[model samples]
Target chain A: MAESFEITDEMKARVGVESPPWTFEVTTTGVRAFARGVGYTDPVYYDIEAARKAGYRNLPAPPTFHGTPIYIPGKSEETFSTPLECDITVDHGLPNTIDGGKVTEYYEQICAGDTLTCVTKLASLDLKVTGSGITMFIQTIEFKFTNEDGKVAVIDRLKVINH
Target chain B: MAVTWDNINEGDSLPELKKKPSLTQMVKFAAGNGDFNPLHHDFKYFACEYLGSVLVQGHFRYAALGELVQTWLGHNQGGRIKKMSCQHRGMDFPDADITCKGTVDKKYEENGEKLADLTIWTEDNEGKQNSPGAATIVFV
Candidate 1:
């Protein structure tokens, strides 16, 4: 638990610094899994034939369902399965964190068989104290998903609250 | 009938999508999203113990709201989501109803594409808006 917290100059400097690019893959099985996980009954997310008939080349990724990151043992976060290299680590001493929110912007339709090169940047950092007197660090990270053809397909902003 | 820019009007409400996510469903979401965070599943995890129960993944609600929009769009026949955003205002527990709702805020033509801006959210069983959001969908 964080008794007190403040943003350091070093942490502030890390904002806007882009991390090394990582690969995120959109696959038929992955889209199906995510769609099923979300309890979607839409056939376009499960059957390629239905997807094609619906005007998609392959199974379409459902809303808010971005491609999964390529995970590598020893270089990935075991708990989250995210590439460790893409993390903009802040030494905020909070031990617990929660998802505060998310914002996703889509430029192109993301479908199965597409590989997106993703880059993340720390967008902003702020410190807040809750009504219950808990100190928290709010960090917003921006992710850019660029398709194989080099066109940016998606931009996601995720806000994480660490307390 | 498919929803089109010509038919959709401002202030229209989307058909509500209700969900009651079970623990097993949460596990499936964990596998699909690769977020094995114990706080979401392990009952003995510190955060879960501190919070009194396993909390639902915020993304789960976000995606639920997305599902609400997709269902209204006739599963791609009406249109596609161009932008979606949400703010998690409070924690939600599993096995409880999370009702997704939205209202069309505006409709306009931009750069030859017809688009509508919507105010979206997921409310708990008590009618408390736990996750309030906004979305933009383009008519195909």
Candidate 2:
């Protein structure tokens, strides 16, 4: 388990702060496991010849495979702390949860042997009082993925929720 | 066979996926996803610590939604999907009947491949949206 950061008043003011860029080298094993984890048994995720036949330089990763690079060990930890505005007295129970649900404007397909670099930043944060007893605090974190040629590959917008 | 835009239209709803999440299902998914958060499996933890009975991991519903998408798209022969995004709106306790559904919002060609803009959502027996989002799939 990783150490959790304390949410101070200053840190709370900077809830939507940007972290330094983190780079992850795409691995074949990571790609295969993600596809299989989602129950996709297609050969394109594993068979190199099939990928070549499909116009890919090598076996390509699945669409959702990009999360592996961004969500791995150290890339998204400090960003996982509870935002300052959350009304909860302490942060012990829930995992800082965020789900990115939006259209991904694809610029390029990631083929095998591609080293992807990601630049992540906290985009926005808001606190709203629901009519019910629950108070909803939402934080948006955006991550941009770029390939070896410095071309943008994908953008991931993750919305974190604390109630 | 390549899927064409003319072959489909907007407001086309795919078959709904009916599933009941069991404790075993939650445990398996939690294990597979490396999320052992007790909120998913620990009944006492949820009842005592979090004020719930038994809950399902939100990602499990996303995976089920993915299943519904693959089945709707008629299998992407060799073409790979570009991306999928899902917004989770509600929670699923154990033994809850969850259903997944989607509609073809539009169709267009991108980079020489036929693509579909699909708007998808999931609902439970009581008619609550569980997860809502869109997926851009290149039809092969």
Candidate 3:
């Protein structure tokens, strides 16, 4: 909890800055792992035959399961497995963080055997103080995932609150 | 039967998806989503200790809501989720029932496509709506 916090000019300048593209892979194993994690019993998410019968070229990624980022030893986040090259650093010296919310818009069906090039941009930043007198820094990041054909398939807006 | 745009009414309620996530399931989610946040799986993590127990990841509930929509749409059919959004309002602990429910709010067409907008949410064991959001689905 921060007693006093503000979004400085430097922080505002970070908005709209696009990060370098990173590779995200949607493999059969990745799709099945995500399906199993979500407790899905749908065979279309696991069986290639079932997926084909359902009109999908391959195992379909679950609605919210964006493909996993290609992980490298030092270039990826140790915990999240996200590529560090696309991370926008905001020098907000906050000690605590919380998940504010998320919005995902899909333009195409994401399936296994597809490779996506993902880019992220700092969309916006705001500061809010609660009635308890604790200041919070709210950051909204936009991620765009484009498939091999250079078509944007998924866009995700993630909100993070730091206090 | 599959839920088609023609068959679903504006006030129709989707079948509820009930989830009871365990510690092992949490770990699997951490692996599946690549979010190895210790507060979700490690009870001894400092944040978990502060909260008195390991908390379920917000994305877990988001994915469950996705499952709810997908199951209703019937994967064998050609329905697609055009958009889905959610806000994390409160913390949910593991081993508790999380009920995902939805109600169709509107039905319309755009550029020759049939669409239905629905309000969706997940409720904890006490019936408190912890995650509330909306989704738009397109029918073939």
Query: What are the chain A TM-scores for all the models, listed individually?
Result: 0.95, 0.71, 0.96
lDDT of 2 at A36: 55
- Identify the superior model by lDDT, candidate 1 or candidate 3: 3
Go through the candidates in order and give each one's C-alpha lDDT. Answer: 0.90, 0.63, 0.91
Q: Model 1 segments beyond 4 Å from truth? A: A1-4, A129-135, B75-78
Best by TM-score: 3
Considering summed lDDT, which 10 consecutive residues are worst modelled in model 2 chain B?
B72-81
On the 0 to 100 scale, the lDDT of residue B64 in model 2 is 69
Q: Could you report the DockQ of all the candidates, in the order they appear?
A: 0.77, 0.29, 0.80
Clashing pairs in 2: none
Top model number, lDDT: 3
lDDT (Cα, tens digit) per residue for candidate 1, span B40-62: 89999887888889988888999
**Model 2: CA > 4 A from native:** A1-16, A67-105, B15-38, B41-54, B63-84, B93-98, B107-116, B125-127, B136-140
Q: Model 2 in CAPRI terms: which quality?
A: acceptable
DockQ of the two-chain complex in candidate 3: 0.80
Q: Between which residue pairs do clashes occur in model 3? A: none
Per model, how much of the real contact set is kept?
0.74, 0.21, 0.74
User: Which digits, one per residue and each the tens of the lDDT, describe model 1 over residues A49-156?
Assistant: 999998888998898877899999999999988899999857787777778899999999899999999999999998788899988899999999999889999999
Candidate 3 docks at the CAPRI level of high
| Model 2, span B38-140: residue lDDT tens | 6777778744256557676666777667667755554335333466778876777888888888888877887898877788788988889878877777765
Model 2: share of true interface contacts reproduced: 0.21
